[model samples]
Target: MTTNLILTNSLDEIAEFVTLLVIFIIVIGITYFSIRIVGNIQKEKLGRGNIQILETQKVSNTKYIQIVRIGKKCFAIAICKDSISYLCEVDEGDLQFNTDSSISKSSAESFKTIIDKFKKDKPED
Candidate 1:
């Protein structure tokens, strides 16, 4: 009878520990999801602005061109690492894109082409 009582006490302690662990897990999950939901809600509320980016194209390593729409007019702007400049006004019909995929066919090919070009252009030592 004493052994059975000890076993029953140990089992109750283990069951209480498991229940506490489960409660802690549930609390942590709730806290994580609540924070995530609040952050997403704040981001969505802050994203309602008048200026919208329509298109972007990278010109070089440090230069890019973007078309942005402000209210009713759209303009093209050039962005560099140092400064941003207004390029020109963009009409809807003036947009053009290159359909060829030869520029970035593969990462290895692009690297190899760049190295070859540098070697060809390198001054004699």
Candidate 2:
């Protein structure tokens, strides 16, 4: 009878250990997945903020160009039927043009219109 009791006790201990290990593994998996979800949420928030900034700063005209500025640098991005082109910097004091030949006249006109509107709407600093 004593030998039988010892064997039963050992089996119970092993079962308890396995249960604890399984619980620990589950907890760790949940923690890892939680961190990943939170990180993705933060990245999406940052991307949305950037898009809002771009939309608010965009200028569009029917006959001329559209312009958007990324931070301090200005870009004269033109939109055509199936292509996009970057013309020249419309910012004052710097007359730089893109060396790439892919830029079209329609794009230049659109960029010029956007820059002109931005200049007009800018508040004095």
Model 2 sits at a Cα RMSD from the real structure of 17.5
Q: What is the lDDT of residue 120 in candidate 1?
A: 96
lDDT of 2 by residue, 12-113 (tens): 999999999999999999999998899789767865642211211123542234454566666666665566677766573454445443242334355667
- Which residue ranges in model 1 land beyond 4 Å of their true spot? 1-32, 96-125
Model 2 C-alpha lDDT versus the unseen true structure: 0.62
lDDT of 1 by residue, 1-125 (tens): 99999999999999999999999999999999999899789667746767766666789999988887787787999999999999988885676544455342333445667879999999999
Scored against the true structure, residue 124 in model 2 reaches a CA lDDT of: 86
Each model's lDDT comes to 0.79, 0.62
TM-score of 1: 0.47
lDDT of 2 at 52: 19
lDDT of 1 at 26: 100
Which candidate achieves the best TM-score against the true structure?
Answer: 1
